[model samples]
Target: MENKEIARVLWETADLMEIAGEDSFRIRSYRNSATSIEGYPERIIDILKDENRKVTEIPGIGKRLASVLQEIVDRGSCERRDELLKKFPPTALEFLKIQGLGPKGIALIFEHHQITTMDELEQLCKDEKLRLLPRMGAKLEEKVLRSIAQYKMRTGRFLLSFAHEAAEELKKYLAETGGVEEITAAGSLRRGKETVGDLDLLVTGPNATEVLERFVAYPRVHEILGRGANKASAKVGREGLQVDVRALPRESYGAAMQYFTGSKEHNVAVRTRAVKMGFKLSEYGLFRADNDTRVAGESEQEVYDALGLAWIPPELRENSGEIEAAGEGRLPELIELKHIRGDIHMHTTETDGRASLEEMAEAAKNLGYEYVAITDHSKAIAMANGLDETRAVAFARQVRELNRQDRGIRIFSGLECDILKDGALDLANDALAELDLVIGSVHSHMNLEPAEMTDRLLRALECPSLRVLGHPTGRLLMQREPFSFDFDRVVMEAVKRGVHFEINASPERLDLNGNLVRSAKQRGAKFTVSTDAHHPKHLHNMWYGVVTARRGWLGPADVLNTLPAERFRNAIRHN
Candidate 1:
């Protein structure tokens, strides 16, 4: 079993221990071990077995936690962790994942009515089981039900790219139909947050009044949630579509965009810096020494230059030392989407994707993209209907025919080959060599110890045919965490061996997160920011990867897809 899986089990054990009224320090140690195990640089087994090694060497772990880590890694389970969990009903820890319920509330529920599951809890809520208990009442019961429903109905936020596209569509429609001249998507979508909460568009046109009127009256506007003279809110299907239309002097457009696209913390940092310099900054523009007159600049860069600071990358504008970096003129040259010439990771009908070869080609053509790597899954991924050697070869032939037809898009027949349990490639080297690109990935063995998982990935990276590692960490948002692995070493080796890693744009799996991306970029390793889309609509998710790339402070030149098709193909073919 992997160290990460072991850690998760141990984490649950700790939570259960907490519910059972175990010693606070004891429960805290287990929880600490869980967090430490997540980002471990080496395998837990090696740490456990080594005489000189200490688990306290791992960050967030101390001496008490170290022994627990050793016991879990060496014996596949820890007796202390198990013993504590046995005291509490197993359901106690399970309820902790629910948002509103805390340890105390859970204890009350379990102690009173023996509620073990969500269903049982719901039944208790229906039967007024909590009302009879001391302190709990009818209103709290309703709130709990509401919280439970919310937990059940909760969906992850859309990727920034999806929000951008939606904004673009809305902007275009508003301008064409609503006659708005200045339409821009503001908020996190503009600032390039990795995920977006909602779509915010600011419009400024000759007919501001008419535009706002028409926007609120548009057919797609399901209900007028709110309407004021300067701004309005409406329901566009289920997602909250908040549209704000305000009348401002045209010169302030740039500042307005910057202000609205703020990480509030970042803006405060900038404002404080401005204050220190004896100047006042606002969304309207930079003011005079007295903080009253507006300066000239219709662009964000101009505004920053006026303040003697380099324009900060939107992704890094989260107040995390970016202001200091900007002041020092040491801002990172973020990666740009235009630098991506080709997409090295994608799917098609051969696996579990919506597009056909021709449709994908045409879409690439429309995007002015140079090339695409069609990496269908191999036979091992039965869930995705992966291809075998025979089918893979046939797919290559079809790609060759398409190339010959001069479709204006270079097609690289690639395989998203699975890394086997024993740290071997799913395809033979010869089979792998036939493809233009190879995106080796780990789908199983996710529960392996950090060392084993790292070894598995490293072995795959050592394969010459492996050009790109898709979603290197292999997380599924809140559902799962990356198993224990030596990511630092894995990235170092992948970079040294000329392997490309991906910032997968799948909403659920934005693996190779901004922090990791920054680390890899610093080492001169290349990356492919791909949508990893399963449907046509998903292709638009490229923006999510784009935003994530920006968050890593990546510029266009860092990504392989930003290259033109021929150059991209040559790079992959040779590397």
Candidate 2:
């Protein structure tokens, strides 16, 4: 199992245990281990397979938990999860996906109503029945119904990172088999969509027949949905993501990639262009209208060249003006991962982060970054033991001391200060001024009116100490919808105030998504593509942020962190 899948197994078990009213310490162990495993840079399965390695060496992983991990890897489940599923309806886990309903809430509902499916839960809400439950109210019921609708819309979708892992694993498995010369990912995975519905792989080699056969027998293949000499389909991984693989002739490789890696609209546009040019375009090849002779099919560049356009990057293949931009030779040179010199929004152990300040700085330096910012939580987050004024100023001086030691990375002392509901900054002006930067964030009151939310952000921007607005939308991908707001107005104000926006790179919270990024960029707003990382391994997620920036048509010049150490320092709002 991949590290993420293993982490999910333990996390779900922990949640089930919590609902069962199990020991809090044991539950905390499971939760901590899950967090550790999820942020681990290497696959847990690989460590288990290595004779020299011990799974117990992983922090928080005791011998018992280690054995549980082994059992999970062996058959995709452990005894604990199996037992818990029997005690509670398995669908109770599904109920946890609702925004307003957590494990405790689910337990309350189950104890009172014994609801099994989403429909019953929705009915309970609609009937005004849940109001009688402890701590539940009419407002909670309304939120539950809305959350259920959102959950249903996102039921089959998996995060891009999850699907990417599955696709990469399949590629590696197939590469070992003969006749698999090249394996390339296509579809939404290639396009860097935040969520993927399914996976698509294109393969080419001398003997495709053997590859197709090997594909069906791969270890992760839970079920072979279909099979053919040149193509195959299967459900793979614990996520049961449907994967389709096509083995194509080398001559048609590029044509097939173009046809398969498409947004339906983009493909339609490309095909229409081909038709206008007196050529036929399909997965096979580009052919003359007057004859069946193949024209350009060897490479994507050739295909685009034949169509009298430049090759569009996969991230820009949403048919949202990329085709026109390509034809006009006006496509932006998108930002790349290598262009980033620093990651400015991250946490350390002093707040809610797992890693300490020195450790986070070391990880950043190892990644070849010249600078990093430790933007730990400010005083508003009581649960995180967030920093008050004295602690915040002390931490800034501590970072200053570390920088004096020339630890090889310039550590900027900062705080992710909350923006209070009444449009005020969480930390005092003098406290914020003691730091290099302050990233204003909203951690509560996400359901404010659109005008209120807009005004809230607009008010936050007036704080001169604020540099970057952290995860501006406050979205958690499929789990939560963005708070309603006038985005353009808020972004315009940020630009006006010389405060930049942040492209938060956490896979679960790639907030300020492509559309919003592009919208803000067009309004003359600058940005920082940060991981908002709480762990060292999470820093690697910068690539996902770069992909998001590319989708927004942002170039290196548009992102402040892409600047060099001193330049980036001087570029942001000076304290």
Candidate 3:
């Protein structure tokens, strides 16, 4: 089975067991195993093939979990998952997808009201029956109604991060099949859309039949939708997300990739240009329209050159004025992952993080980062075990001691301080002055009027200790909407105050999204693309932030954390 499919099954089992009131340790074991499997760089099947390999070597996979994974690889399903499904109505799982609902919430509604489906839950909310249940109110009922609407709008789409994970595993599996020469993921994933409905994979090889056979027999294939000599389609996992693979001869690889990796609008624009240039363009190859003579098709650059333009990065192939820029030889030298020098917003066990301060620092060093900031939560976010003045000061002392060891990476003591309802900071100025940097954020009162929200942020910007704004809009994709506010005014005030905004790299919260980043950039504002990591493994998420910045047309000069250690410290001090 693919790693994502295995991970999905394990996570679903965890959710079901949680609702079943299983032992907390067992539930946590499943959760941890799921996380480890999802983030693992290689397929478990490949790992298990080594003669000396032991599944116990995986961080969270003990003997029992390894057996379960092995069973999934041998068959397409697991016994534990099937057992749990038998105890609940088949439709019960669907309710968990609704926002404002968790395993506990679903169990409560099911036991009390026998609600098993989204339709029944929506009816209860509309009839005002949900408000009579425990912990349910009129406001929550309204929120549920809105959440259902949003959920329906987002149905059939997977998060970009999830799609990328699946694509990576599938690509690796296919590449090792011996006959595959080149394989590339196409479709919305190549375009870097925030969410995608399905995946398109294009392959070129000498043995087309061998590639097609291996693709159809992939262990994660839940069902084969169709098959042919050179193409096949299959549905994968419980979500029934379709994946289509097409094998092509080597000569037409580039043209097919360009055709499949398209925004319809961008493809139309390119074809129009081809026509104007007295040529024809198709997945077969570029050709002379008058006599069907082939021109260029061996490479992507050749395809672009046939139309008299430079090669455009896949992220910019959205028909959003990228063609005009390329025609003028003005395409941006987009930022790459290697250009990042530091991660400026992260946490440790002092707040809610799972790793220790030292572990987080060592992980940053492993990533070749010159510096990392420990921006734990401040006192306003009590749920995260946020630090108060005394704890904050003590934490600074610990950081100082660690830095004194010359650990090969600079550690900056910082706090993700909360901006309170009245625009005051959660930490006192005396406490803030003890830290090397500060990241101001909003943790509550997210439903204020637009003017109030704008004023709240503007007032926070006035504080001399505030250096960066974290998750500026407070958005969680597919679950919560960004709180209403005057974003333009917020950006303007941030620019005037010399406060940097963050591109938070957590998968669920890529806040200050691409458009806002571009808007801030156009207005001469600087930014920091940070992971906002709470665990050592999460440090690798920095690449997601870098991609978001590239989509916004940002370069190395637009990012503050790219500076060297001394210069970065000076920049933060001056701000």
Candidate 4:
């Protein structure tokens, strides 16, 4: 078949399996392969005809799948895949992307009522056809229609951080209207949640009428949701971009900002703490006056100080022990990106990476990293151009010679060894021991039951040569949830075994998310935040990982890789 035909088939198959609720990893392989084919610079068939052709060397195509791909290319179809694709049409795949509509849910809606396309699906949902189906009701139908309308209007939502940019744009417009004095973002956007539901803006202005008029007339204002004297809300663009503006007096600005910026739980706790301390907390400001005399205002810290506590970071202000820690003066001095002395996980051309060993080392030097661990893929993950012993030994020699050069950065020979189903490392211990750091990871076998999966992971952690576990949860955000595992117990076992956990910095896979990173830190497990970068551009993913670490309240001393070069080497050697 033609390349486009093959790509279409693969995409449809993956979508069908998604509707079937098949194992995510297995489903992901097909999706990744489809993406690879679609984006590949060379034609798939042309690449297949070369003598040196090895499809398995592609980043997303593993050995077994590569062979299957060859068969599909030769025969113009995969009989098995075609049979599966018949269950779900390509047109219906669009419905699955809507919020609250998983593949199984879509399949159920389609199966019961023969819903086949987005328009049909939307009408059925709006007309309450889904309510007549099992396990669905009027409320569910309304939610489905709303979600469908949203998806139809928007490509996707913005990341939580990006919401600040949108809020700032609207704020600046309102500020220039000659009535507003101060503006800020509130709600989950301010608290650093990964994804925001909508953007919320609060402004203190002199004239409510003028400010409201200006907001409604703004160039980007697509639709006005509501407008009142004290508050006005609107949606911008097809993405449902929301901006909320509130008018407040100068006296109440600080308190209002703090209250609105808080996670509701955090606000409740703070207010309770204030009441117990014989003060009242509100949007106007913290006050001790029973007869309306001012006590604290002008600054958020002063308000917190009046209640007797240090300021807590927005990321940790989830009412998750942050207030108590502040009261006890035990808030961790969170680590900064500058403190990272070395990177223990990275990729080079020995695998599917875009850079060679020398190039990666020089890049590390430029970044001021004291050391770079060149952990290319191990043999078990052939799709990543996983190295065999012969090639690995040669690469080791190359890295060693490079290390001896006059470069300022130290280079550590390393491999991201895949953990097999039988709880064995992809490379032998002796082979791994020759390296400075060995990162054990699960690249497959996501279908294992929770108990079995936990055991498999624990066994991999027990490897003496294994120094770090990479992306232990195996989740792909928004696209897929992590595989089933008792992460608490996993953290406990990792701590007990003296193995390190990795915060994979690949933007697509900031694996050990901030909350879990904090949880693991509290359990005595050391961490190394590395980019797991496959290309030069990906090295910056470390910044996201750092923010995640800070969210977990980790300090410089808590990260193993932030040690001085000598100490970092010693830690590796000792482990």
- State how far residue 281 of model 3 sits from its true place (Å): 2.1
Task: Point to the candidate with the largest TM-score.
Answer: 2
**Displacement of the residue 304 alpha carbon in candidate 2, Å:** 0.3
Candidate 3 per-residue lDDT, tens place, 395-475, comes to 889888888889899999999999999888999988898898899999899989989998999999988888999999998
lDDT of 4 by residue, 348-372 (tens): 8778887787787778778888988
Q: Which candidate comes out best when scored by lDDT?
A: 2
> Model 3 misses residue 434 by how many Å?
2.1
Indicate whether candidate 2 or candidate 4 has the larger TM-score: 2
Which 10 successive residues of model 4 have the least lDDT summed? Answer: 153-162
Better of 2 and 3 by TM-score: 2
* Per-structure clash totals for the candidates: 23, 0, 0, 0
TM-score of candidate 1 on Cα atoms, chains taken together: 0.68
> Candidates 3 and 4: which is better by TM-score?
3
| Model 3 root-mean-square deviation | 3.6
Model 1 accuracy (lDDT, Cα): 0.75
By TM-score rank, best first, the candidates go 2, 3, 4, 1
TM-score of 3: 0.89
lDDT of 2 by residue, 320-399 (tens): 99999999999999889999999998998899998998899899999999899999998889899999999999998888
